[model samples]
Target: MLDVKDVTRMFGTKAAVDRVSFTVTGPAFVGIIGRSGAGKSTFLRMMNRLTDATFGQIMVDGTDILALRGAQARAWQSQCAMIFQQFNLVPRMDVASNVLHGILNRRSTMQTMFNLWPRADIIRALEILDRLGIAEQAPKRTEALSGGQQQRVAIARALMQDPKIILADEPIASLDPMNAQIVMDALKKINVEDGRMVIANLHTLDTARRYCDRVIGMRDGRIVFDGTPDQLSTGVARDIYGADASFNESATSTAIPTDATADRVYADAMLS
Candidate 1:
């Protein structure tokens, strides 16, 4: 569904993303994993046009996304929902209203300014909350929810657009283990049930290996490994994280279950 060819982003002397090339052909869950400064987040941002790439091209379906401007770009971006590590919910807004934010582009300036979403829009937002298992909280202010509930609200908001692609940049980075599992399960359910293309930048290889159909490993801005979780060998993990990678036998022996799914996904990744 998305094609990135030789994508490079540079800021003066520093190169954030370098010659990254990859493709997503259908509704699949894909994970982009790397250590800090590896450019995973920058690459995701480029796809959403949050930051313009210094060079290279990103195509959605068949359209060159970078070529879109103004209204066109906004329209396309609305179809590509972004979930951040920090749930960026408006504190004062009700949960349903926050989710409705996804459709801002479709509203008139006056309608949005006054927060007057159409009745149908409100119904749709409530339905999304129900599907996400947070319907009861819809009338509550965002500030009244817990972190996990807040993130779910963020996902509900993203779904309100009926987005074709979902980009989650470290969605579980701030949560505890149980909450992380809840969030990952929600994402996995969306991918499996709705077949929405989900791409996430994850800090732990465990999550990627567990939930992603394929894992793309990055190092110093280039793709070093890309394949199924089962195809990823110990050697590959070593290469991606060095000998001290957290998923090592000793470090991961006890926490295996929490990361088992990610381990399997990475293990299944192709050797290429």
Candidate 2:
């Protein structure tokens, strides 16, 4: 359960996120769709409390997340995991250790210094890596893996926290279309299987329509549209992107369903 009311963030004379408001109850995959500079990333940052809101409130349950301080703030951030376009893994560290570091918020300094993680935590990290389809890469150095694999590693690290909410900022922007689909599918899988609410800042309309349960369209730092994917019509999308009538929407599609997607659609549909 998350509620954001009139939240705004300003930089000098500029407002990057202006009076954004929404409520998401229960588990659902929500996509914030927009072009560059639409304040999508800033909005997610504010939700994660990595950047403070200049005004208004973000409530998780009944608690005002903006008001939290010290350990409480750190605890809130831990429960709200973030996955970024850049893998953010320690390149020299083994994949398993990088994933295990997700627990750094709660682990003691001595334990981290001595690499004395409990057996159960290590096993849990392996389990998360396995679930993300990167178990084999666990022992390898993080920099050795492909972009998609590394992103999954990032997701595994987030899952290591048993987080309640997952915030993905331009999650697949740096990958090829195929790898992008893999990462998106992995995120969807997590949302479905674990019931963790996923809020992603997505540049591609096709990805949002195909994956998200709800879509929030932003433009010029304000929420212009909020509805189901089906409601994001051509006109609506045009307004969100500030495009002219002849503007080609196809250019915004980064998700071109791989053979994996086709199998899940036409091929797998036959079995049902």
Candidate 3:
């Protein structure tokens, strides 16, 4: 379980995330949607402690994680893994080593310095890659893989931490439509199969509706809507996106059809 109470982050005088409070139970896929300047990214960062919340209580189970310090704080971070837009892998490094890096916080200084990973860690990394359907890429340099594959490697690295909550900041924003679907599907599978709670910051409304069990829409640093996917109607989306009537909701969708029939439907919609 997770509880974010009155979470707020201020930049000098401006509040990026203001008085945001929400509770997320175990093993659900939650999507945070909004326009460019909404606090979605900042909120995810705060969850992973990549960015500090000016004032808030972030509770996991019954404890306030925000109060942790030193090794304790680092342990909290290890349990709450972050996946970023840029993959964040060492390009020249082999994929297995990159995933093994996730456990550096728990290793001795000399072990990390010499890049010596325990046999158990390496085996677990391979297992995670296998589960994500990228096991074959484990021996290849991360840079040799395609964009979609690299993102999967990043996911494997996150899994290496055995995180209870996975926070993704625009995991698919840089990918093409097809690749976007793949990454989202991977996150969904992690939530369903591995029982990991996932919170992703997404710009595409259609993708959110397809994959998210719950949707939280942010506007100008505040949550404007919080409900299930079905509750997020077109009108509600417009409010979150600040879109006027001229905004065709489909235009905001990043989905691309894989079948011929669906492709025709998408094409016709474009023509119409």
Instruction: Give the candidate number with the greatest lDDT.
Output: 2
Q: Give the range where candidate 3 is weakest over 10 consecutive residues by summed lDDT.
A: 259-268
Work out how many backbone clashes candidate 1 has.
Answer: 21
TM-score of each: 0.90, 0.92, 0.91
C-alpha root-mean-square deviation, each candidate: 4.1, 5.7, 3.3
Ten-residue stretch with the least lDDT total in model 2: 262-271
Q: Quick one: RMSD of model 2?
A: 5.7
lDDT of 2 by residue, 107-133 (tens): 888988988889999999999988888
What tens-digit string does per-residue lDDT give for candidate 3 at 1-272?
99889999999999999999999987989999887778998988888777888999999999888777788888899999999999999999999999998888889999988999878888999999999889999989999999989999999999999999999998987787888878888999999999999999987666777889999999989999999977766567657865443334434455544422322332344345
What value does the lDDT take at residue 43 in candidate 1? 91
Model 3 / residue 215 / CA error / Å? 0.2
Q: What is the lDDT of residue 181 in candidate 3?
A: 79
On TM-score, the leading prediction is 2
Reference-based TM-score, model 2: 0.92
Query: lDDT (0-100) at residue 234 of candidate 3?
Result: 58
Task: For candidate 2, give the lDDT of residue 42.
Answer: 95
- The C-alpha stretches of model 2 lying farther than 4 A from their native spots are 244-253, 258-272
- In candidate 3, how many Å is residue 73 off? 1.2
